[model samples]
Target: MTVSPRNLRALWPLAPCACTALLCLCPALRGRGAEDGAGCGPLLKGSALLLAAGAGPPTLLVRPRSDYVCCHLALAVRLVPALPLGDALYLVPARQALWALDASKPEQRLLAWLRQQAPPDSCHLKCLQILKGLRDLSGRGLEGPLGAQWGRVLSSYALKTALFSVLLRGPWQAWQEQFLVERLEELVLYLRDCLRKRVLMHFFLGNPHVPEAVPVPRFLREAAPLNLLAAFDAATLDAAATQLLAAWSQAPKIIRMYSGPRHLRRSPALCRHVPEASQEAQSD
Candidate 1:
């Protein structure tokens, strides 16, 4: 059954009800875990604390500190199950690109102001690190109550990232600008694939009680490399990379007919769009 985007939106209202059912059905999906100690509870209590404490926007700009990472890991391990739905801080960094923040303060304000005026870089490695960390932690044999919690946390993060991408790319530029469109499309496909894998992992490893499991075919279709590659222009080696990412995203699970390794080993015939330098390198 094709799940239309409209149908997904329609399902939003039922989220609360679904969560309530999960709680009743799965006893393991309840209570805080070992990470939330006495002092930590009040310190990281609410979203208001982050905003009011002068913490900047919740983005990849924040650096991950030991304490902050510990706090997030705890929340994912503990608070995820009983509530099963809500935003939770996963990681925070100590420093950021000075430009990615408001430079109103006397201390680093000038630095931030200058950085914003500069041209944007292509790869934000800090953001990429956080994404990789999330993927690693979510797959690290975390199960039972903590698994459910981690699942919700990861899924929430994915959704937030998607929304942020949309906001950052805007409708006009997202469609018209080639580079921006490519970046945004890659991000969308990445997050969507992450959500699918995390959800499946949570159900298979963490909670057996989850009634409506996300279908494998649906995820495969959504993460299809060909479909994802369509977002890129007709030519370019990056198209293959896009396809690889899509396939890799679907590789973790045991899908009946898909042979991930075989696809990985066989290279597609180079299209005319391959760069001259790439062709030279391949020939050599």
Candidate 2:
């Protein structure tokens, strides 16, 4: 059967999910080190070592390596325990003046340590306040050693924003579909790249407390909030399915190495496109 370019283009949004399914369907074609039972023990061990080094006694006072490592650990921890609840909670503070603390001053170190001890749920708000304070202090030309500290705060906020976008929005869903499939295709590609980067970072540098092997099913379950499957109708889903199948045909072997073989098989029957199916069914 000949599939037209247009037909294939129409199926692109479902590429991520379809690729997932394909991995499940062809177990024998799996690459080396693709064994399903592989443990992430090695990866976790490395992360633990990094964490100990990063969190160990303050040896070099000049660079603030402890601060940087702690921040990354905090980000990693957030990914597993909490869902990005909403955009409002993730917003950066309007005032960036509260972060101005003298690095050399004992009081400043005390303040920073206190802020660090704040509960994770309250960290966002406390961090925002610190940033605003720093920005204001910087304005007055009194920031001194806290300059680098302010930069770290801002960088953390930026990372949080990017992570929030991924968690709250589906990787396959687009801000605009009417313009062309190109934009949506770009989104799929971008999400895939983002996922790859995150996985690699976690694999290489993540904390030891984190699990070594993140099973494909477990990852998908965590990613369910961002899958975009809940948002489509049968017609849209079908179009997505077609695009995904084509995309999978061209996916790199490494990308398909994570999951089991059964994931690739489509349902025995195709879905019907009823725009109101979810709403009507819910009301019934």
Query: Which candidate gets the maximum lDDT versus the true structure?
Result: 1
lDDT of 1 by residue, 1-284 (tens): 12333434554564465445433433433345466544333324331222122254222112234554553432221112121122210111112321111101211232243234323542222233334444444446655543444443344333333433333343333333223224333554555454433321221112222223222222322332222122123223233233323333322232112223332222233122334555566468
Error of 1 at 189 (Å): 21
Q: Against the hidden true structure, what lDDT does model 1 obtain? A: 0.32
TM-score result, candidate 2: 0.16
Q: What's the lDDT for residue 198 in model 1?
A: 32
Query: What's the C-alpha lDDT at position 127 in model 1?
Result: 31
Scored by CA lDDT, what does every candidate get? Answer: 0.32, 0.29
TM per candidate comes to 0.21, 0.16
Candidates' RMSD to native: 21.0, 26.3
Tell me how many clashing residue pairs each candidate has. Answer: 7, 29
Give lDDT tens digits, candidate 2, residues 223-277. 2122223222344334433333333222222122322233223222112222345
Q: Candidate 1 — worst ten consecutive residues by lDDT sum? A: 98-107
